[model samples]
Target: MSVRVQADPNQPQAQDQSFSAAFELQGNPDQGELRLYTPLGSTAAGIQWTPINAVLQAHGETRQFRDLAQLITLVLGTDVPVTALFAWLAGQNQEVDGWQVDLSARNQGKIAARRMAPALPAELQVVLDN
Candidate 1:
């Protein structure tokens, strides 16, 4: 899968960040689905920390989280609502990268951790720096 994120360049905001990232995730792994434009996409399988009931897609792939609450409690071990992760990442303040998958499945909901990546394309970075 090739996942590309087109960030709005303006980050570290005092408000929302959810709309800050524009992501494009597509390829063989995500065929027959509208996986082209999204903030982020990930599967809940192989997540020992947050073992979920899981809702399988048509092509036998897992994406849509089935149990949100149980997933969060298991991953975070706290009572933080799972949506907080999404809410925070979707905001326009935080920019990070190379982060581990932190998802908790509990009674409240499934929360996903925000992982930001450093600005890349060395050539582009240098061009923008000047």
Candidate 2:
């Protein structure tokens, strides 16, 4: 899956900070691992999270977070509705307060979602590798 983040232009601090990345997400939101791959296909970073805490390993260094939300926010620059995401991936159209998700292409192993409220809106696109 690949994710593209678009910082809100209205928020001066968020401008010029958008980024894109491809990654493999495994397990469930409660306890899962997300591995980001480099352009050359090597592992760039790995994030593991559980109910108790979250750990990020990258650049030969390991960092810890109090929870998955904190870890995600730190890495993605915004909070993502991960729980809702799992539901979306499973073909369930779940509604999140500040986000809109589209699963119309789930049969084709594709999903798209966008955050429209608060600040620092972002777009998430996922394509399952079959």
Candidate 3:
């Protein structure tokens, strides 16, 4: 999976950034784990969350957060529609506020989405290995 975030013109500090990693996302929106791997296939980061808390482990350090959404926002510099993302991955076209998803290439194991509102704009692209 790869993610690219365009700098928000309204935010002076925001800068364009891109990330690519092999990731595994499990469970539902309320309780789940998202693990990212490096290009060499080693674990890069792991995020696990429940209704109570979210934990991020990376670079030999573990940090806790109030929730998955907060943790994701801090890391990505924007909020992602995680709940809708799960549905989209499952071949369901779910509408999410401020975001648009395209699943035409889902049969080819490809998914693309873009966020057009709410501060930062981002583009997310995923290619399933399976």
Candidate 4:
């Protein structure tokens, strides 16, 4: 799975830049592995976790974190509800704090989500390549 993120222009700290990344995710929030690939299709980063520990691999190095969220933040520079993402992609709405995912147009291969609570509300629009 992959998503392209855009920050709301109306927000103060919002940036005009957009984020695009590819993901290879499995399992649920509690136990899963997610790998983010570079635009060139190289392995940019990866996160794997279980109840005991979470690890992040990037730049030919591995770092440990207490949870997936922490590792994700460190990697993406922001927090995304990846768990809810699967549900959203399937056209089901899952509650994600500060974020509202809209899949109404999923049939058209488009899905968008907005972060409402953050000071700089951001929008994430995903278009499945498949």
Q: Which candidate comes out best when scored by TM-score?
A: 3
Listed in order, each prediction's TM-score against the native is 0.22, 0.88, 0.92, 0.76
**Model 4 TM-score, all chains together:** 0.76
Q: Write the residue-wise lDDT of candidate 2 on 11-130 in tens digits.
A: 678653444567888899889999998889888899999999999999999999999889888887778888998899889999998899889999999999988887556788888776
Backbone atom clashes (below 3 Å) for every candidate: 25, 0, 0, 0
Global Cα RMSD, each model: 16.3, 1.8, 1.5, 3.5
What do the candidate models score in CA lDDT, each in turn? Answer: 0.29, 0.84, 0.89, 0.75
Task: Report the Cα lDDT for residue 58, model 2.
Answer: 92
At residue 7, candidate 4 shows an lDDT of: 61
Q: What is the lDDT of residue 107 in candidate 1?
A: 22
**C-alpha displacement of 124 in model 4, angstroms?**
2.4
Which lDDT tens digits does candidate 1 get at residues 1-130?
A: 1222333446554332221122232222112111222344453223211233423233455444445455433332322223333333333223234333332332233223433444321110000000
TM-score of 2: 0.88
Candidates 1 and 3 compared by TM-score, better number: 3
Error of 3 at 13 (Å): 6.9
Poorest 10 consecutive residues of model 2 by lDDT? 14-23
- Which is the leading candidate under lDDT? 3
